[model samples]
Target: MVRPLLRQLLAMAIVGSTAGCLITDRVEFEDPENLPPLIESMAPPAAKVVRLDRTRSEDVSFACQVLDQNEEDTLDARAFLDFARDEAIRGVTEVVQSESDARRRSVTASFPPDLFARGCHVVEVDVIDGGAAGWDPGGQTRFRSVKEGVAKATATWFVLAYDSEGDPRADISLESCP
Candidate 1:
């Protein structure tokens, strides 16, 4: 009789655990037709000219406005500067500033004026949506928009040469090295 009672208790526990799995209150389902983030505009437009003083220093700021169709989805933005000669600038920080809504974000990136010499630098902005195209399990969320929810924009920075007197010269050349 004791063996029968124990067997019934074990069966009840199994049923209770299986029933809990069927409860998907915490599971989040996403739309498979989610759209990628869009870059609406960027500051310091393409082919922008910058006259920098060798003696004085100032930060070069790059910003972008990104928009995502999915309002609930989170977005991230990054910016980088690369020289025309395949040399990329390092230590540039990309800061993403989000508004009250999650659909739009303003991203700013900057590098010290000393980091860039006289040359044409290509500034690229990349915006990515927090992959909401897949479902989220009960415990943790999963990301699957590896290639779908991404956008990129590119602009050119023309840092003009300065004379010994700290005067900006009219040099439009892209040579960074002597």
Candidate 2:
């Protein structure tokens, strides 16, 4: 039969041209000198429901916009607020420097809305990139054994609780902003 259909169409055209030149030595990527810190943008956004007016004192901010390709290192931004927490409240970072972008950075975190009490919180933003040597300056090891630049960002709001003609209590708390 025409020489077995011309040797099965020349063995399917040589296995479809060598199957895209199968080359594999375990190739991975993303290592432009340990690249890590890059949050881009974050604020009272990412679920957003915030409406806590226990009488309004104001001071519940959190912002982010960190980007680092190792642009001279030094960038430790942090902000956390879990709420139904056994621990996790820390928020008082304020590193600013990006009038245009020297590699970008503008992290702001301020809390004190009574440390949030009405429910559903979770707003973590961490951007660390001091060039990561792991940091163990002999303080007996204060953590961060090695996380290679580290970058984290999360947001989820909902402090609602205001029903005395203040309007903001439609009762929506399945409780899970962890």
Please tell me which predicted candidate would have the highest TM-score against the true structure.
1
TM-score of 2: 0.27
Model 2, 19-121: lDDT tens per residue?
A: 7666679978875665766676666664556555555677767676777766767766545666335344385366677777678888777776676665455
**What TM-score, over all chains together, does every model reach?**
0.53, 0.27
Candidate 1: C-alpha RMSD after superposition = 16.1
Off by over 4 Å in 2: 1-31, 38-54, 63-67, 70-80, 83-97, 109-115, 118-123, 128-178
Q: lDDT by residue for model 1 over 36-114, one digit each (tens)? A: 6677776765445555555556676777677776776655444455533543334333435466766676777776766
By summed lDDT, which 10 consecutive residues of candidate 2 come out lowest?
Answer: 137-146
- RMSD of candidates 1 onward, in order: 16.1, 14.8
User: Which 10 consecutive positions of candidate 1 have the poorest summed lDDT?
Assistant: 135-144
Off by over 4 Å in 1: 1-32, 83-97, 130-178
Cα lDDT of all candidates, in order?
0.54, 0.58
CA shift of 167, model 2, Å: 26
